[model samples]
Target: MDLLKKKIQDEGKVLSESVLKVDSFLNHQIDPILMQKIGEEFAARFADAGITKILTIESSGIAPATMTGLVLGVPVIFARKRKSLTLTDHLYSAEVYSFTKKETSEISVSKDFITSDDVVLMMDDFLANGQAALGLLSIAEQAKAKVAGVGIVIEKGFQNGSSQIRERGFNVESLAIIESLADGQVTFKEEVVSR
Candidate 1:
């Protein structure tokens, strides 16, 4: 994850004390090589979880989740923010508040994609308020799927997201955790070696 930390230091922009924009490489215009590395990291971390599927939200979370799925040889399922006509009524839904957008939206996943037999590994680009992960967990619960773990690319450690998820007994792994983003500066928490 040193490579990822270096990438953030080189390209990430701290918009404010609470926002770090990494659209240049992480989310908007993705760096597939970095994503592949991230996927490999997650695959290594959760290698013994018996994961059957990777789950994430639509849009931002899809890239990393897909890459992780590819590495783990598991299917990826993303929760759609907007319900479409093509989707059937048999779905599991939850309301998630976006830390960046500052709005709440209903996220849904088709029941057919997840089932009781699945051991799901949830992945996301960022973890701020833990709302998205919570929503995904809700969906997984609705399907009776066992949550294997959560893999996050960037975690805002100043926030309570990580602790919240941990309190719920979910094993959460974040590649780079920002301890502070004060005065447009990014400070990371001491990296825990996890090869």
Candidate 2:
């Protein structure tokens, strides 16, 4: 996790009081080594969960989730932001409003990949408004699956997302938790937030 926090310190850009863009190495252009470390960290954190599958949203979350799935030896399932022609039926869907993009998108997952017997571990690049996490949780709920927990690469600790998910009794493990992104500076949380 120290490596991840350092990466954020070095490459992350603070666009506003609320937005810290880490697209350089996390989302748009990925660093395989960093992602592998992230995978190892997540796997270590959730090692006792008995996870059967990993669920994440498309685009940003794929890289980290896939890496996590690889480490945990579980299948990864990503919810598509836009439904394709090949994916026409038996989909579990939910609306996720992005605070960063300022848009509400419907994310969907196929029922074929998930079932009630599975223990799901959800992962995401960031946790801001709790929408993406909630959407993934909803999809897992639709499948009647037991969620092991959520794994976040970067958590905006100033935001309500972490508390919201925790209020529902879901464990959240974030590699780097930013306490503030104010005045063009990135401030990480001084205290540890345990799962």
Candidate 3:
């Protein structure tokens, strides 16, 4: 995970006190090798969780989730934000509010993809306020699926997101935990802050 932290340090842009843009090599433009390594790491961490499926939200979470699925030899299911004509019925849905986008979206997944017999692992590119993770958890609840754990690629540890998930009695593994993004500086959770 040091490689990922280093990548963020090298290319990540702290746009504001709460916003860090990593579109250069993560969400927008992806590094396949890095993504593969991320997948391997996640697989290793959750190798004993009896994971049957990988769940992620649309757009940003796809790449990392797909790679994790590939490495774990499991199918990845991404919740679609936009509604499609075919995604009309037998779906598990939840209301998710995006902290970065400042918007709410109804994320849905097909019931055919998930079941009560499956153990799901929620994966995301980033975790801020835990809204998206909560949404996925809601969907999993509706499906009566067991949650393996939550895998976050880059977590804003300064936020209450990770704590919220932990409070719910689920394991959360974040590869790169950013303690703060203040004054246009990136601070990892491991580094002590005097202030």
What lDDT does the true structure give each of the candidates?
0.91, 0.91, 0.91
**Worst 10 contiguous positions by lDDT, candidate 3:** 80-89
What is the alpha-carbon RMSD of candidate 2 to the true structure? 2.0
Candidate 2 residue-wise lDDT, 37-139, digit = tens: 9999999999999999999988899999999999999999988896333455789988888766877888998889999999999999999889999999999
| TM-score, per-candidate, Cα-based | 0.95, 0.94, 0.93
Worst 10-residue stretch by lDDT in candidate 1?
A: 80-89
For model 1, name the residue pairs that clash.
none
Sort by lDDT, top down from the best: 2, 3, 1
Compare candidates 2 and 3 on TM-score and give the better one.
Answer: 2
Residue 113 error, candidate 2, Å: 0.6
Q: What is the lDDT of residue 139 in candidate 3?
A: 93
lDDT winner between candidates 1 and 3: 3
- lDDT by residue (tens digit), candidate 3, 22-61: 9988889999899999999999999889999999998889
- Model 2 regions more than 4 Å off: 83-88, 193-195
* Per-residue error (Å), model 1, residue 41: 0.3
Name model 1 segments beyond 4 Å from true.
83-88
